[model samples]
Target: MAPVSVVMVGIGGYGAEYVAALDRLPLEKIRLTGAVEPFPTRSCAEPGLSERQIPVFPSLEALFQAGCEADLVVIASPIHHHISQSMLALNHGCDVLCDKPLGASIQEASALIRAREASGHSVRIGYQWSYSEGIRSLKRDIQAGRFGGPIRMKSVCLWPRTLAYYRRNDWAGRLRDVTTGRWILDSPLNNALAHFLHNLFFLLGPAVGLSARPLEVTAEVCRVNSIESFDTVACRARASGDVEVLFYGSHATQDSYGPRFELEFEEAIVAYKTPVGDVKDEISIEADGRRVGIYPSPNAGDHFAKLTEAVRAVTGNEPVECGPEAAAAQTLCMNGVHESISEIPTVSSTLRRRSVQPDRYWIDGLDGDLRRCYERGVLPSEAGVSWAIKGQTIDLVNYDHFPTSENHA
Candidate 1:
C-alpha cells in the first residue's frame, strides 16, 4: 500500500513536533506531503519543513483551492482554528487529528461532530494522554470491573506559567479573541491542564472503552494572574451513573505539579501520579493492597507515534481510539465552565502576588491552597477561603443555549 499523504496545518512550536514525528516514521508508512502555515517565512525555517522540502501553503483554504491532495490533515493550530480547520479537512475528504479541547465551546464541538458524520471520515482529538498505554490499561481494568465500578474520580494539577508564556501569542490568556471574534478561553482547565480533566471523564467510561458523558457541571473559576480568563479552577461534574468527577487546576503557583488522578471504586482505589512538569513520567498504579509501576517512562516520541498508529487504524477501517465522540465530554464540560463564568464571583485579598521574574507574578500561597483542595476533594470555596465563592451548577443538556455571540469568529 502507498504511504498516507498528510498535510499539517501550522508548523510552529507544537506543530513542529508533529512534523519531526512524521519525519521519524518510516517513509513508506506516512509522508508529509504539504503544510498550511500562515507565516511561511518563519515556519519554513523549521528544520523538519526545510529538510523535507515539504510544500507549504498560506492556509487550509488555499491548500484545498490549489487541489492539493492529502489522506490526512493534522491540525496543530490555535484554539480558535480547531473546529474550522478540522471541518475544512474533512470536507476535503481527509481524516483529521485536531489538538485538544476539541472546540472552544460545545456548540462548536457539535458542529464538528455533524461535519465528521456527514463526511464519514474519522476525527481524533489530540488529548495525547488518552493514548498512553498505562491509561489504556486502567480503562481496561475499569471496564472489566477490576475496581468494582467507579464511585468518584479526581484530577489535580498546579503548573505555573511565566508571563512570557502568555505573551507568546495574541490569543494566550484571553477569554475571547476580539479580532477573530473567537472564544479563546485559554484557562488552566481548558488549555494547559485539560488532559487531566479529560482523563477523569475518560476513566469513567459509560461504554466499555469510551469516555464518560458529563451529565452536569458545577464550577468555580478565578483569575489570580492579570489575564482575562481564569488561571485557577475547581469543578465538580456528575458523569453517567451519578459518578462524581472532581477537577482542580491552576497555572498561578510557585510550584509545578504535573497532572495526577485518583479513581475510587467500591472495591478499591486506583491512582496514578506523574512527575512534576512531565506527563510522560513513569506511572505507578496504586490499588488492592499493592503498588506497581507500569510502562517505561514516556518520551516526546510516544505522543506522535501513537497518533501515527491512529492514522494507520483509520486507513485500515479499524476503530480509531479517542475519536470526536470520545472528546465530546470534555468539550461539554468546557462549555459548562464558560457558562458558569457569570456566576463565579471574583476572589480577592487571599492571593499574595509575588514577582517571580521581571513581569511574572506567582501566587505565593496558591500551591498549598490548591493542594488542600485536592487532598480534601473540595472546591476552593469549600476549602474555607474567604474570597472564594460557591460554584454554580449547569446542566449539560442546555449546552446549545450557551452564549455564542462571544464564541463565534
Candidate 2:
C-alpha cells in the first residue's frame, strides 16, 4: 500500500513536535506531502526540512489549490483558525488531527462536526494525554465501573508565563481576534494548560470518544495581565449525575507548579502530585495508599500516540480514542467560564507584582491561593476568599452557541 500522505499546517511552536514525529516515521508509512507555514524559514522545525525536499505552502488553501492532496492534515495552528482550516481539510476529503481544546468555541466544534459528517471524514482533537497509554489504561478502568461512582475531581495548573509568551502573536491571551473579530479565547485554561483540564472530562466521558456533558458551570475569572481575557481562573462544573469537576489554572504565578490532580470516587481515590519546580507531567494513579499504576509524563516520548492513533484511524478506518466530540467538553467548559463572569476582576494594586527577567505581572501569593482551592475541591467563592465573587451558574444543558444572545433566558 502507498504511504499515507500528510500535510502539516503551522510548523513552529508545538508544530515542531509534529514535524519531528513525522520525521521519525518511516517514509513508507507516512509521507510528508507539504507544510503550510507562512514563515517556514523562521520556524523551529527540526532542520533538514529543506533537505528532505518537502514542499511548503503559506496557507492551507494554497497547498490544496496547488493540486496537492493529502490523506491527513495535522493542524497546529492558533485557536482562531481551527474551525475554518479543519473544515477546509475535511471538505477536501482529508482527515484532520487538530490541536487541543478542538476549536475556539462550542459553535466551531459543532460546525467542524457538520463538515466532517458531510465529507465522511474523521476529526481527531490533539488532547495528547487522552491518547497516552497510561491515561487510556486508567480510562478503561473508570469506564468499566471498576472505581465505583465518580464523586468529584479537581486539577490545578499554575504555569508562569512571560510577557513575551502572550505577545508571541496577535491572538495570544486574546478573547477575540482584534482584526477579524473571531473568537480566540486564549487563556491559561484554554491554551497552555488545557490538556490537564480536558483530561478530567475525557476520563469521565460516557464513551471513549465522547466526554460527559457539563450540566452547569460556576467560575471566577480575574486578570493580573493586561489581556482581554483573564490570566487566572477557577471553575467548578457539574456533570450529569451531579458529579463535580473542579479546575484551577493561572499564568499569574511567580514559579511554575502543578497540573497535579486528585480524583475521588465512591470506592477509592486516584491522584498525581508532581513536586514544585518540575516540568514533567508524569502520571501515576494512587489508591488506598498504594501506587496502583505508573506511566511516563504525558510530555514524555509517547505523546506521539495521538499522531500515530489519528494516522491509524484514517488509514485503517478505526475509531479514534479522542475525537472532536470528546474535546468539545473542554471548549464548553471554557465558554461557560467566560459567560459565567459578567466582568473580569482585576487583582488589587497592592497585591500585583511584576517580574523583569522576561517581564510579567503576577498576583502575589496567588499560586498558594489557587492551590488551596484545588486541595479542597472548591472555587474561590466556595472557599470564602474576601475578594471572591460567585459567578452566575450557567446552565450548559442545551447550551449551544457562545456570547449567548440576550434572548437566552
lDDT of 2 by residue, 187-302 (tens): 98889889988998988987778888888999997888888888888999999879999998999888878778787888778777774456345666667777676656555567
lDDT of each: 0.77, 0.85
Q: What local lDDT does model 1 show for residue 46?
A: 64
Per-candidate Cα RMSD to the true structure, in Å, reads 3.1, 2.3
lDDT per residue for candidate 1 within 1-409, as digits (tens), equals 8888888898887888887777778888887788988776666336557676777888999888988879889998988889999998998889888878777877788898899889988888888877767677678778888768788899888888878888888888887887977777788877878888888888677563378888888888766666788877888999877898999888777878757777788877766666656544565555667764454432323776556765696568656668777887887888787776574444464555757465566665777887888888888888776556765688885556446444453
Candidate 1 positional error at 263, Å: 0.6
Worst 10 contiguous positions by lDDT, candidate 1: 292-301
Q: Which numbered prediction scores highest in TM-score against the true structure?
A: 2
Mark the regions of model 2 whose C-alpha exceeds 4 Å error after superposition.
275-301, 406-409
Q: In candidate 1, which residue pairs clash?
A: none
**Over the full model, what C-alpha lDDT does candidate 2 score relative to the true structure?**
0.85
lDDT, candidate 1, residue 284? 51
TM for candidate 2 is: 0.94
